[model samples]
Target: AQQQENSEKVAKAQGEQFQSLTQIASGQADIAKLQNQYSSYNIRNGMYTIVAAQSGQVVKAQKAGIGEFVKEGDMIAEIVPDDVKYAVEMFVRPLDLPLLANGQKVRFMFDGFPAIVFSGWPDVSSGTFGGEIVAIESNVSVNGKFRVLVQEDKDDRRWPRQLKIGAGAQGISLLKDVPMWYELWRNVNGFPPDYYQPASGQKNSKTSK
Candidate 1:
């Protein structure tokens, strides 16, 4: 009986040792987990300042200046990512829209550059780039055609391919509505094919008779 009692005591002591070791290991694991979580929190807090991803001119400014109240998701500025190609967006009348399509040739003339065509000169020049109508926005209405976004090739390498309108530089010089008004005004005045041209030559001679 004494021998059996001793065996029972040994078994109990072994179980107690195992439980103590398990508790110690579990406590260490919890400490490591807490430390990891604390480190991640600090890293996230350090990244709070919003910064521009790339260097470029800002093209649009929704809200800016000190003491301005900005709501969540408010557009502060637009950054034209570096090395990106750009295109001028000119809205054509709905009637003229049908004449244009994807893959059709386009001749671009910028006000900044006076030249009508690009002569492959090393210097920046105003001229047409090799481009096609990649897309057409179809929200046509009484206000005229909707916005059309165009992508230009960036091979020129004169200025950064993309330009942000409102950052570090001035915003888009003229509002887009101006062009819409011009197109509408021209339509009212009967422009291009819509203009009535008086018959000349033989027709006028016959009319005199």
Candidate 2:
């Protein structure tokens, strides 16, 4: 009888141990769930806040003002970095499109600045900044011209910091090295030298061969 009583006590102790282990496991699971909820809450809170991904100045702010409804993927602001790399874009006519390609050096004369450009040779050009063609749009732009993107040449002098966004720029892309007399002949005899400046002031890019 004593042995039987001892056996019952051992069984009872085992049952209590099992209950404690089960409770510990359940508590751990609850802790894990709570931790996940906290992380999700943090993520949801971040979505409501306007945070800049990088260190830059906000040039333009939310157009809708404060406490306005905005859907996802909407442009809230435009940021400009302290050391900004400006991109200059120009459009080329269909006839001139054959001359331009990627990696060609371009000479630029910013609208706000004065430059005495020789067009073909950039070395003798004063007050002109150097750039290179980066992108040529496969499709025609809204202006009915092929859009070309120009980036600053890292080896050349940096552009002026005071330059504003959407600033006008005149780009001369030297397509081929041809005789000066030939260029004059082409211009004189109704042969278009790649670009024609219309009075509407829409197209400003010129290419020379």
Candidate 3:
């Protein structure tokens, strides 16, 4: 009887040891599964890779540096795309506002390409190309100057490939198709041309002699 009791106790102890080892093995597998899930989530969230929406050369870097901290939606850099088209913006003096109009001819000589000068009348000048006035800002700038947009004259000549964007340029636009004497007279008298007409419902006020 004593031998039979000892055998029963030993069997019970062995069963408890096996149960404890099984629980430990299950816990380890659960931990490994959680680690794999976390790694997959990190990859999907782009924690290791960053890609730009469009391909372009970075002109200015705002926050892209090693060991730098950046939040979501923060601007990393300024990129000028390769396919971007260039337009010239010229600031016109307030005094010259009356002489400007859309569709007028414009000539440009960029500082980068100083050897070339674009003129409205190519027959009278060398190295002259062509452009047209596209828009004129209604409001004046802080410096009392108005902005004008000039586009390349596709019908006349194409813009040079060597010309760079954001380059400073000296632009001369042709005034209204009036006589030279009239332009000179207006300049001497300090009179603004009738470029802007009164509204349809408004009447022109004139002092009777």
Candidate 4:
């Protein structure tokens, strides 16, 4: 009986040792996995590389100076892609909003190219380029101006190839075709040319009896 008890104790000790070894092996494997995951993050010369999500030209950089500390989710830079198309943004007077519409032709006279003068009438080509009104913001700005977006008009690709972004430009959009008399009357009365007509089912509350 004494010999059997001693043998049993030895077996138990061996089992416990095996369990401890298994646990250690498991911990080592976990550590190796964590190290591999951390290795995937590009760290060179003790500096981590922050890659941009999309490749583009860096238009503006914030906190780019050396030794500048940046937190996660901080905006590091603003990039404008080379291939991305651009549109002209103009602020229009609130009173002039009624005369503008999407798809209307816009005459653009870039400040950079002052020699050119764009005209909405005559459909003639000059140093000036043509654009189409693509969008008009409904909300007025704090300064009582409305934002307008004008894109390059189709079949009228006379825009300068190397135009700088945010270049100041003046634009004028053509209104719908109207008789000369009506235009003169509107101008005389300081009334905005009407481009929108009420729907058949809707009535102007001010005009309705």
Best by lDDT: 2
User: Could you tell me the lDDT of residue 57 within candidate 4?
Assistant: 88
Question: Which tens-of-lDDT digit does each residue in 1-209 have in candidate 4?
Answer: 99999999999999999999999999999999989777755355345566776778888988767888888888988888767677999899976777777877777778767644434353554567789778999999888899999888876866888787988887755556789898899999988666543234665677656
Better of 3 and 4 by lDDT: 4
Best by TM-score: 4
How many backbone overlaps does candidate 2 show?
0
Supply candidate 1's per-residue lDDT for 202: 57
Q: In candidate 1, what are the lDDT values of residues 61-158, reduced to their tens digit?
A: 87766667777877789776656655556566676665555534444444444444333331344443433456778787557765444445344324
Which 10 residues in a row give candidate 2 its minimum summed lDDT?
192-201
In model 3, residue pairs whose N, Cα or C atoms come closer than 3 Å (at least 3 residues apart or on different chains), thus clashing, are none
Candidate 1 has which clashing residue pairs, if any?
Answer: 57-164, 58-164, 58-165, 58-166, 58-167, 59-164, 59-165, 59-166
Off by over 4 Å in 4: 1-47, 114-125, 175-209
Q: How close is candidate 1 to the true structure, as a TM-score?
A: 0.46
Clashes of each: 8, 0, 0, 0
lDDT of each: 0.55, 0.82, 0.76, 0.77
| TM-scores for candidates 1 onward, in order | 0.46, 0.61, 0.62, 0.68
